[model samples]
Target: MTFTDVLRYTAFSSDPEGGNPAGVVLDATALDAAAMLRIAADLGYSETAFLTPRPDGGDGPGGRGFGVRYFSPKAEVPFCGHATVAAAIAVAERTGPGDLVFVTSVGEVPVTVARTADGRLRATLTSVPPKVEDIDPADLAEALAALDWAAADLDPALPPRIAFAGARHLVLGAGTRARLADLAYDFGRLEALMLRLDLTTLQLVHRVGATDFDVRDPFPVGGVVEDPATGAAAAAFGAYARELGLVDADADSVLTLRQGVDMGRPGVLTVELRAGDPRIRVSGEGTAIPTT
Candidate 1:
């Protein structure tokens, strides 16, 4: 595929400058993994999405289906929420909004795209069943050391845990917004620890309200220092909150996560949890970045 084959878009915000930018290749059937990686690294985005029509796939009234893969600069990731959102919108702009199914490395993801009242396209992705587990003390300590955060800086109420929806993230709650805002960390040290633990990002969060949070993601494993807007971490955090009884599990709930403010690319991520379904729903607005 040539450079023209890639589409640049930002997820979680309609304005191209405010959200996480990603490279979306609507058709990558001719490209191999190495080529995809090279393209992703060259683009210098947090992640790039590559899609190919599946042999068993066929277009229907609902929408189209494609096998999707996510590649960071250094390696392939299991899943990427922001890139998925950006790619879905990129597809909808050409194919029209409707239901979309993405066969990802983790599992099949169902996405619904619809036009907003303001005419922007919005996409919602239902995550796979989520699971939360306690992190080992030693591992947690190593991570904190890498981040230059003391254990006392963490909120005791929220606790620390490893959560997974499509990707693995170590969720750490900061006791104060100031702690979360100051995000200078040892990149190489953190990357080594994250690689050992198989973590995609460190979901750093500071609670604003019962259902609101200020969040940041350190994505060293993905070859990025930070993610402006992270959908996978938002999904995992939703599960972590529900599993910890921080939210009402028997009833539907919505959460708002504000991220990238410190980086000056503020974006918002909406997470919805239905009572009957254990899966989390992540919704965001996306738009194509204008080419100069």
Candidate 2:
């Protein structure tokens, strides 16, 4: 396919102008890795998704599945949440909404999409089973130094963690909303630390209420200064919150994450966790980016 075949969709917001924009290549059968990376670099989005049909698929959505891959402007990632949501919405617009599976580098991720009553398409993706681990003291200190944040700036109750749903994220909680708003970091330093830690983004969050949070993601490793709305990070944060008992893990819980407001590209992501289920489900409204 030609370069213009790429479609743009904004995830986590019904308004195209309000969410994280992602490039979606619904059919990438003719493109190779180098070509895909070139397209992503040309688009300059945080991440772009390239999908090829999976014919030897197992169970799910009409035996029609896709092998999906994600590439940032700099490199390929194991998975991307906003791009996943965007691609699902793109396919749903064509094939109609239902169950669809994406065989990713990490594992198979199941996605469900349906049109909302308001004429917007909503997509929910069930992440691979999530896990959380402790961060090394040296690494934690280095990350804080890069962000120009001190130990006192952190919320002691939330603590620091490394959580993984589809991709790895270092979870850090701010003591105040202002802490999250004022985002300035040494890009080279933070990117080096993240590369060493194999982290995708620093999931910096400020809890607004028991179930509301304001999140900002620093993604220097992806060649982006910051990610406005990060669904993968949100999913990992949901798992982290459940493990820390920040939410009722034994019961059904839904949390709202408000992101990108400081950057003037506000987006909302909904994270859902069910009782006895380890997998996190992240849902959001997607809109087509106007081609002008």
Candidate 3:
């Protein structure tokens, strides 16, 4: 019988008290779908990652490479950025920092891990090519109603759209940071709309600068009230901002996203965009959640 080694790591922040927490099963080859889901549900974090290494001597942490699947407490998701970072750092801690590949349901993701001079481990995940689309007016109204937000509360410059990197996110920009911080919504109504539209989270954002944003995600579909430091949505937002000509497309840009302040778990996510590359890169530091 094989035992799966499970650990908890927080992504996008060096402090364990900050960032988003993820359950990491470095070895999950023996587990079936039911077993994995059960583990994830019992953990009750936003998401948990399961790894199944390739047969060619890839069964160890930071081995050659591995196949990764992400599961929320409720259901499996296509991709999860924070968990990806958490897993990468976990592997790098054991095998040293370098490049790693994750064969995900969406596609192959290339991640580079490195240790900083300050003794922090950070990982960057390049997302699949992102796409931006228009959302129906009815759907938009429904989302606003559920959140008790008026259409006038939206930032006219940013607009509203559906963005996709590895997973689908509904992007709505708030005119003010205060609006972004206040988040009390109808969970069931939002969940129903998210299910119908296949949305992973609602990316509520307020631009602080040309490249900095204060953001929040409502993830009722994931069986979580909110997500702190949502790197997946940050990647998708990079594409959305680029599409709207909010950022320079010809120059490499670094975007900073601040999240989870109101919930008291402040975290930061760094999003990078290359001049010609269509894929967005989301980077953040990860720290181990100490066993208590």
Between prediction 1 and prediction 2, the one with superior TM-score is 1
Q: Which has the better TM-score: candidate 1, or candidate 3?
A: 1
Q: Estimate each model's TM-score.
A: 0.97, 0.97, 0.96
Model-by-model lDDT, in order? 0.93, 0.93, 0.91
Model 1 Cα lDDT, one tens digit per residue, 102-212? 889899888899999989999999898999999999999999999999999999988999999999999999999999999999999999999999999999999999899
Off by over 4 Å in 3: 1-3, 55-63
User: Which parts of model 2 have CA positions greater than 4 angstroms off?
Assistant: 1-4, 55-63
Error of 1 at 267 (Å): 0.5
Better of 2 and 3 by TM-score: 2
Local accuracy of candidate 3 as per-residue lDDT tens digits, 1-292: 1338778999999999999999999889889988988899999989999987854455435435878999999999999999999999988988898888887899878889998899899999999889999999999999999999999999999899999999999999999988887899999999999999999999999999988999999999889999987888999999998898988989899899999887888999999999999999999999999997
Clashing pairs in 2: none
Query: Using TM-score as the measure, which candidate wins?
Result: 1
